[model samples]
Target: MAKLTLPPLPYGYAALEPWIDEPTMRVHHDKHHQAYLDNLLKAITGTEFENVPPEKLLAGLGQIPEKIRAAVRNHGGGYVNHNLFWETMAPQAGGAPAGELAKAVGKEFGSFDAFKEKFAAAAAGQFGSGWAWLVVTRAGALAVYSLPNQDNPVTGGDTAILGLDVWEHAYYLKYQNRRAEYIGNWWNVVNWTKVGELYGRARK
Candidate 1:
């Protein structure tokens, strides 16, 4: 019901250095993600949806009013997904999953390398603006999924534990036309601790 507000970046804009540049990070967070939050707030104002929290709206999208559904779907999803995406990385994060997440990755995809390969392929293969996700299906299995333009695994009955923004704004400033390179580089900054936490909570 209240206005959707932009969440702060977990680390400084420049923290994702070498992979994602500071200017890009600043624009991506301050401009792109904030636009989504502002638009979502505008889209739902004075409607029945106005009172719903951004996360709750995302989690129960089917209940959103038909009148503003598309706007909310796009903007709200951008807000929610990007928030998760930011938190899913840390300046000092990345490398490999530890604890149960490492074991699960091995079990699900044979090894972390294989998991990286699959996630990268999925992210690269997305035809346009969208996201690549590591999700837990309702059937209680872990899998990779790609959703077009702000659409997310939540819509398909999966719990997203990890995600990568494949939108041009997410990479163009740094990687130019080399999205694959961006995807490859992103693996180096993944916040496995946050991911592990999401996976642990979702699995339970």
Candidate 2:
């Protein structure tokens, strides 16, 4: 099987400006995310995992060969998660959920502000490198979850509808030590259209 390749950014590196700078997006996507794609491919070379799609590899980490499991879990998760992360925002996105997502948010948390508070708290409270997620439970309920380094809600059977990369590298460039500010600004770029689409699919 061929090795996985890094996907191009959906928009220009500078597209996310102000909220996310050009140089940061460039390095994060080109260098860091690409390294994960390369390392994951290298780790799976000549192994059964070589045939697995990068996204599927992340969804089934425990089933990978033990010799390369850790590499796949780390690098593969990074690759998949970052892929989703990049598409989860845009320079023109964010503000508030819309359509069914807005209604769901209203029903789930009473209002959008409440949801934001919970999500921000979850992101800020993560003790170390990890991600914060808005996921749909198997029972069709929405919930907030935080996972440590490369961990995702998929590992626990929850379907991630949207997520935020809370790793220091994700925010250090712009927010410095103020992680809350980073989380707050992140709300300004969320691609609610994509998130609502994912939520619909997950609910089905």
Candidate 3:
């Protein structure tokens, strides 16, 4: 069986300090994310789901074997979410989108600050244990939504440009119960370059 493996962080552990401490990234990536990958790999053994790319599996979760479906949802979602989360951020990154992406944000949300306020509200307001997503809806519009547990928007026919994990585990150690503060500081590392790339792909 083909197994999924944890990918190395693009930057060193200490790369995203202060706003997102080295300790949090270390534990979140090393322990939590790895555990999900390990479990997902084990769950797919001897199943036809083995060797299929995770995005494909997640985008078509209905077709997976029922026996291992739950494991695939939780662990596979974790695996995919963490990968995107890491890529969506950078050490010295942050600020609003530029060029075409900036224009789209203006069209969709009126202005960059308006978009931030709305996105921050979604991130801070998510009930509990979920993610805040900026997705390209099938209608070619940008939309914001939240999902519980490890559920992803791809399964609902949307492409996520960016996502923010609001689960306590993502912010507890550093921000404590201040999910609002975490959401605020998260903008400091919002890799708009990558987000623009994702936006271009979503439009296709």
Candidate 4:
């Protein structure tokens, strides 16, 4: 509500190329994510919501004024979702988690490969525009699920350890209609370091 600004990409648009491509990152980060921030600022400008953090606003969305609830939900969620999406990947990242994260995933999903299979399936099977997540559930274990549109597991008391934007805008330019290919390649860019840190935070 305090004039959310688009987060600058920590890496160049072309850094994640070969898998994500330059044009898609440009539009996704600069144009699309920016639009969500701009619209969210306008939506909360004169309301009681002004000054609330977008993540806090979303975590407590049920308390928002009904008239502007939908705007805040869509745009605010877009803002939070996109920011996390960017943080979840890096230029040369890949392989898998280490330390406690590896232990957690292995304990919960049998093994890291099994976890990848489930997570990738979630990303591939999601219909239409949505996000797939690996989240720390309320029960203190990892879980995988996909949600429609910009919705995330946070509102339901889970912490998103990883998320993928399965919306066409995320990979349409490079993958065309091949979302499975996109999902498979996406693992190569996984910033498991960041994800493991988030997993630690979420566990506490």
56-138, model 1: which lDDT tens digit per residue?
77778888878778888899899889989999999877899899888989999999999999999999999999999999889
Q: Pick the TM-score winner.
A: 4
Candidate 3 has a TM-score of 0.96
- Global lDDT of each model? 0.88, 0.86, 0.89, 0.90
Question: What is model 4's C-alpha RMSD?
Answer: 1.2
Off by over 4 Å in 3: none
**TM-score-superior candidate, 3 or 4:** 4
The clash number for model 3 is: 0
For candidate 3, write residues 31-115 as lDDT tens digits. 9999989998899867777889887888998998888889888889999999989999998999889988899999999999999
lDDT of 2: 0.86
Better of 3 and 4 by lDDT: 4
Collision count for each candidate, in order? 3, 0, 0, 0
Candidate 4 residue runs with Cα over 4 Å from true position: none
Model 4 earns a TM-score of: 0.97
Candidate with best lDDT: 4
**Residue runs of model 2 more than 4 Å from their true location after superposition:** none
Candidate ranking (TM-score, best to worst): 4, 3, 1, 2
TM-score of each: 0.95, 0.94, 0.96, 0.97
Error of 2 at 186 (Å): 1.0
